[model samples]
Target: MPRHDHASLFIPPALTRRRLLGGALAAAAVGATPGASVFAQAAYPTRPVSLLVPFPPGSATDAIARALAPQVSKALGQQLVVENRPGAAGTMATGIVAQSKTPDGYQIAIAPATVFKVPHMQKVPYEPLKDLTYIMGFSGYTFALVVPESSPWKTFQEFIAYAKANPGKINVGTSGAASTGHAATMRLAQRTGADLNHIPFKGGSEVLQAFIGGHINAVLDGGWAQVEKQGKGRVLLAFTAKRMPRLPDVPTAIELGIQHVARSPIGLVGPKGMDPAVVKTIHDAFKGALSDPTYRRYLETYDLEDAYLSGADWYALAQKMWVDERKILEELDMLPK
Candidate 1:
């Protein structure tokens, strides 16, 4: 028998290299196939979902979130947790939501209308319309220009006249710069040529305190339904298009001949690129909760009015409002310097 060379006994060099290359390509194709990850992404909210609030525990946003959490959980069959991360005119929570992972549907936020105002007043990391998906609108509070019961200005017109005559001397307290209260006050001033001073506070409670202590001439605030009824303060005017039923005698801004209306509405949102299915599920659950007797009673107790909108409708409204607000702020020169 002739001695066989090892190289000759083996497969050809080109064939060996080709076989290895083909095996590696086949393994890569198997690993890269879109199956498990795609399926996992499709079945979202496999665990608890977080609903972030930019206000403190007892705030209106917090109240609504907590009130609806159970209903939402029941509908979704997942734990819906309320997480408070309040600060920076709601920027703290908004920023967290903005920077969170997108399209995962794990993190959602209850954002105030102030989220739009914040970017105009200060440096914010996210664009209000572009960075988040507006899931749906739930509720809104009626705003009022309130003063201590014994204060001199008895009517909205009287207050406007006083501010017009006093120019920058009349001071008012608000939740913060570019807050709904501040914007409403500014719009009032712009429309009437009143030069009232603005004092920004951290929250509504502080705004209320400032007015009660006589630290400020007036407070521009929402949720005045409870405060007005408490008798600590009197509403001069409802800063809305229509007068609140509870404050029937109190004229609305529009009724007072002012072309401005302000309401601090809140809606659920998630990071941009949220899955349409997840968005629909969240919207439907919250919309149902909004109609639930328990939640409706909570709204009545708080004197809040229901303002519902679908995800697409809410998103469109947000976009349009930002444009309208920017124009108003620009006219008043209230846009950040």
Candidate 2:
């Protein structure tokens, strides 16, 4: 208002699930007659719900979805089938959900922050705000810049200074060119007048591999802390609001005079015209899932932040983010190609 809907406030009894849901469908269909998408909410989720996770299985978003699946299934009284459609920086899966012909709330997706930014980068099959039913946001990732322990730079300051001096000589690795990590790094370069080159990989695991192998000078990723703790690398800076307990010795980018923090917010969504009653049911189920101790602990273990926002709130935020990130895309020459 992200996953566990703004502290579960009472939505006034007048806004009952059925009434609110039916009313939304009626408004969206723009006809006096009831449509399939409108009336389907009355007895929603009768069968298995398909959850399309854009990244590969075992990825961060995939882990979160699996963690939430059982809890949501118990609450909804139905099985949640998580389908992995990893490609095109998560846009492939997004397009699948967008093109779903089912009027029922069976098709849904959990995507990264890039869902809101990718359209500005190039042509995509669906529009973010207009094509999807905005569901609750789950959690946000904790990103960091890490280098192999053998690198010449010891701290974030030294790395930045070196990059500023060397310009495009240094290479930074991320998931993809227009992904959140890449955008944040581009923004940082704009703010700092640095010209470090960025190398895009298919996913974080690939980027981590490249970073550890010295194929890239440094890597900006969400999984760096885990690798750093394993003695494989060292995090020069955390892109979080506060210092993580496990890495107290490392400072945040904000502390180093950088104002932007790049965190990938993960969440669920559905095809356009999903019944509001169905939306409420799914939202409540996911909220129940997020409240589970195991899920919360899993998130904490990875230093990810709880960014729960309600359906209405998340929808509003999506619209605003779409508008807000245009400037960043333009600044990075990422508005197209």
Candidate 3:
């Protein structure tokens, strides 16, 4: 499936936390070999767990992690501290988790699309499918193309027209180079014949600061909901398959006949070789956290979809996404020579 497949994520029927935990126990019983560590098979997560956010503070992923940590901590009977380790377009912290000698459930990070996409673009420290244990996918973002309200372009078409006329003169901003927003903007340029110049920032807050200060003509990011609410900018295009309910007036890139659709699925992942019992404990805790009212409201705030998939299912999806994203980068000539 392409990156635009909003409904592609596998969501199973709801199951109670007890049932989920029971299933995990059964799996652990079957998967355990002779002489396996009794500690690994014992009641898991005996201490505080560290949830690392790859993006900087104030990022969407960071907010989601903070929202989920307390709820997960309550379920696991241990505190889940959210640590900010933002860099390398979200790959640095992920590498830290993947490279850890301990496969204990205490250290985990939020895996974004970049987790898989970056390896294909350039050398990375970890293999997406091999070095990490995918716990669960809780949410995915809805991205948009936002421009200052005072700008002359009133719609996506007008913006494209201006870009077409100006060529590389139209400066577009994203959270970072090769990020979901930057890739989507590049794909849109390919499909529309608009030579849009991409400007990368450290994070969404920085991107917004540059956009608001008129340093860039437009920004494609998930952090535009607040900006649009302040009436400082207008969302010209939603880089989603369907129009976002929060931005009903905004048209989607697909609606405008552009085949480019970008979404960044967020999930929890630990180091490779984690115990099945421990994986289940973390997954069940976060599964319970997914329904938290505050977290649900946070999802709505950014128009993010509730993309829940079990550990096994998310691992399979990541395998497929690795292949799919590689094709996208190859097509864009973004891969190294």
Tens digit per residue, CA lDDT, model 3, 1-337 = 2232111222234645665566546545323211122132346777899988887887777777888878999999999999988777677778899888787778988888878787887777766676777778878877899999999999988999998888899999988887888788888888899999999887777788888899999999877776787898899998888887776898988888887778678788887666666877788889999999888877776667899987767777787788888888887878899
**lDDT, candidate 1, residue 16?**
61
Write the residue-wise lDDT of candidate 2 on 1-337 in tens digits: 0122111223455567876566665333321111224442346678899988877665666667788889988888999988887777766677787677664778888867788788787777767766677777778788888888888889887888999888788899987768888887876787778888988877776787888788999888775655676777888888878887777898988887887667577777777666666777788788878888878876865667788877766766676677777766776677855
Local error of candidate 1 at 283, Å? 2.0
Deviation in Å, model 2, residue 193 alpha carbon: 4.3
Worst 10 contiguous positions by lDDT, candidate 1 = 31-40
User: Which candidate number would show the highest lDDT if scored against the true structure?
Assistant: 3
Model 1 clash pairs are: none
The C-alpha RMSD in Å for every predicted model, in order, reads 13.8, 6.6, 7.2
lDDT of 1 by residue, 145-205 (tens): 8888887888887877888888788888877777888888887777788898889877666
State residue 212's C-alpha deviation in candidate 3, in Å.
2.7
**Runs in model 3 lying further than 4 Å from the true structure:** 1-42
Off by over 4 Å in 2: 1-37, 164-169, 241-249
Residue 91 displacement (Å), model 2:
3.0
Error of 1 at 262 (Å): 1.5
